[model samples]
Target: MATIKDVARSAGVSTATVSAVLNDSAYVSPPLRARVLAAIRDLNYSPSLAAQNLKRGRSQLIALVVADLANPFFSRVVWAAEAAVAAWGYSLVVFNSDEKPEAEQRILSRVRMLSCDGVLLVPVGDSTKHLQRDPDEKPLPTVLFGRTVEDDKSDTITIDNISAGRQATEYLLDLGHTRVGSITGPLHLTTGRGRLDGMLAAMKSRGLAPEPRDVRSGEFREDAAYSVARSLLEQQDRPTALYVASGLMALGAMRAIADLGLRCPVDISIASTDTIPGIGGLRPRLTRTEHPLVDMTNEAVRLLVDRIRRGGEVEQRNIVFQPSLVVGDSCAPVGLR
Candidate 1:
């Protein structure tokens, strides 16, 4: 109800003086500043964030776009990115695309309207043409998190998913499981394609080839993965070991295994590329590759902020973090469990 003009009138000071005192843009006498503060409290005046941002020429807001917020891995990324951005005196707004390119495009259009200072985007598949700006237009400061697009001109932060996939598959192979199957993410996305490629490469290294039917697309959804995994497990020539591309998919496959009245490692071993918080407490701890969540988030935020500050003057950076393997109870040597 109260405006800056009302505060200025109540404090017997010019509106410019009140503005200077509130924004700290210019030095005001201590007594005048005290009077302005007192008048602001008395008037219950609250500054308009839009007006403030207009005056400062910045919103001090960052947009984080993720494929699936329901996925714990993205949740961890949101948590870390929020903390890091808050420490830098900015706020974060999160958007979920549900792994759809059209949804991602809609979100980006909304983000453009918001005048966000920067963006951290985990792209959906390879559809990033919407992110490309005209040559004459100044590009939005953006950091691509987790996924990359072809001919990408923005900074990127991601784990080595290919290596992670290979490690998970190779671990099962080393344990003497020749018949290995996989539930892969959507192959349109690099995360899905890269991990599956790694798994296949690992299989090829040992002169082994998985049957075409053994690999199914989970589409990065738990329910889809559940169905795919259940079908895989129902086959007469089921794989002795299974490799999952993501933690969420792994959980689904585990549930499918339970529903089938089968035991992990005893009936069929399992390994995966990622794990979320609390995954360690699962009945049979998942054997998987772990991402540097904290480090990746910190770097993503830092890079976005730097890009926001430096704009086009900064060089684009592509940062890839290595994944670490955590062996757990879910995997066992073939015929030994």
Candidate 2:
């Protein structure tokens, strides 16, 4: 293993000169720089980037913690974050908490141990206690993505989840769906709760309400949505339309409808919030509200990088993007064939 010392000795220069040449932190004479380069090439020396970054008080790595990586929506987030992080001259490190608060805490602990420059989190728990900084130490630069929690002071980048739910439900209502049902995400997280609230508000404005049996809550997972959809749709008096909360859950509901031999927009109409990769390829071409995924991710990275460069003196910011409804073939008028 050739050290900086070895390279310096071979180049007949002081260690400081070798360090300067390697880091390009200071100007070196052309001849001296050429000698150092020759010595490095002959010795096959590679400087430790981790050590160099540490000495500069930066890891040059940003941590991204998502609730469920298996979900295609989050996978898309990872793809966008990778590009955006690279654009900001930082590397991204990903972590999945699998929607468990304990797992989220453990991942945050690991992020601290790695000395990640900052974090972009999709919060799973009801509070941000695990992400709190020490009193004496500087606050970790963090931006909560997609969701939020209680007692949180960090900057946030999120979608208007309530508007997402309202838009999808309103679209179905405009299509003359009166007997509407829903398959909801867990009622605890902000994304889940706000969306459901929006759906209910939209329904109330139309002088309608869902039957108790028609509203079912499940995890933001395909399998869970499939099971819940199957149970909800199998009822003798099922609603004529459904408002699903998430894209993956909508896929599950569509699958369940297929297995049950029910045709969408005919036997029952479907509308949902959010869309994921390959969702546009479905036979019915799902009608849903779509998020500005790439734009939101880019903004999140920009805010995180800004926070990292300028310490925590700035006021906390909460940026929310709206969802736009994309009409497709899956929905129809209440009595349309």
Q: Write the per-residue lDDT of candidate 1 for residues 1-337, one digit (tens) a residue.
A: 8989999999999999999998799999999999999999998999988988888778989999999999988899989999999999999999999888899989988888898889999998575678754667778888999989888889999888889989999999999999999999988788999999999999999999888889998678678889999999999878999999999889999999999998998999999987787787898989999888899999999999999998888888999999988999899899875
lDDT of 2: 0.92
Model 2 lDDT per residue over 56-125, tens place: 8789899999999999999999999999999998999999999999999999889988899999999999
Per-candidate TM-scores read 0.93, 0.94
lDDT measured at residue 209 in model 2 versus the true structure, 0 to 100: 88
Stretches of candidate 2 exceeding 4 Å from the true structure: 41-44
Show model 1 residue runs off by greater than 4 Å.
none
Residue 288 lDDT, candidate 1, scale 0-100: 93
| TM-score, cand. 2 vs. native | 0.94
lDDT of each model, Cα atoms only? 0.91, 0.92
Point to the candidate with the largest lDDT. 2
